[model samples]
Target: MWVNLGVILLQFLSGSIMYSYIIARILKVDLSKIRDGNPGASNLWRAVGWKYGILALFLDYLKGALPLAIFVSLGIVKDNFVISLAALSGVLGHAFSPILRFKGGKAVAVSFGAWSVLTKWEAPMLLGTIFTIFTIIKPKGTTVQEDAFRVILGYLFLLPYIIYKSFHGDFHLLIFYDGNFAVILYKHYKDLWGYLRGQS
Candidate 1:
């Protein structure tokens, strides 16, 4: 039990690396001074171009995927829990990275990576569906409002899965679906408000 607790704590700490922010600082860019004040891939692309943006995205994904990979390699936890904890930690780190004063990205890629590893079939299928939708109806402008709407709509679409998994007694499923989904929704609380106001 203590070992499990320690692993969880380590996972959270590792997840909070804020790869994008760190890279921005290393490149001598003050992300807070930029438009939208977000240190994510899209903003990085605008500020630095595709190369740095892609690098930051990859590192952010790695920060989540690698730790779980380590957990499995070390036989630190059972398969189910390790995958669950890893996905949670990775996304949590990306969303509320302590290193960046709790300012971070939308937890999309990191969550996708961890989910893909943890639940090979379901995770990919779900994420692919989201990708397809976004591809078809890509948002025009690059604003926090647009990004937030994308996240809120995406999670609303997936809410049914969370309900189904809960009834099926698949708590590990919840670990992947509910915990991460809820985090994304809560993170975009302001966006939700803006969206509702516009509709009214």
Candidate 2:
């Protein structure tokens, strides 16, 4: 029990680091005052530059990937439930970072990182392919709102594929994906609401 608790705590702390916010601070920019007022890689790109944004994205991805890698590699906890819980804790921490006063990013990138580790890279790679295809086919001048919608759609598409290709019979794994998707939608509630209301 103590080991499990420790792993959860460690994963959560790792995810709560807020890499974009840290990068914004280093660039002498306040992310809260920027586009969409989001302290995420996308807003960081608009606030500072793409280079910094890319760096932030990579760091945030590492926040999710490294901890799980360490825990699994070191044989700390091996149960699927514990692994899923620990990974989701990272996503939760990224979404509600205590270090950032409980406000944080939308968890897309961190989700990619955690799912990559959890699925041994298969899930993220497949989803990335889907996102890339969407990006390519999307009309020019696609607004951020449109892109956001596409991302959500892409994930929705991923759910069925994951179920079919990977977890066809594993109800628990399917539930884990559903929970992660729920967390993401909850975090993007405002954006999604605006899109639904024809404001986005």
In candidate 1, stretches whose alpha carbon ends up further than 4 angstroms from where it belongs are 139-142, 162-169
Model 2 deviation from native, Cα RMSD in Å? 1.9
Superposed model 2: Cα runs more than 4 Å off: 139-141, 165-170
In order, what is each prediction's RMSD in angstroms? 2.8, 1.9
Q: TM-scores, in order shown? A: 0.82, 0.91
> Roughly what TM-score does model 1 have, to 2 decimal places?
0.82
lDDT of each prediction vs. the true structure? 0.71, 0.81
**Worst 10 contiguous positions by lDDT, candidate 2:** 165-174
Candidate 2 accuracy as lDDT: 0.81
| Residues forming the 10-long window of minimal summed lDDT in candidate 1 | 138-147
What would the per-residue lDDT of candidate 2 be over residues 1-200, giving only the tens digit for each residue? 88888888898999999989987888799988986787899889887778988998998888887677788888888877788788888998999999788888888888888887778777788778878887788746455566567668768877876677544554545656877888888877777777777876
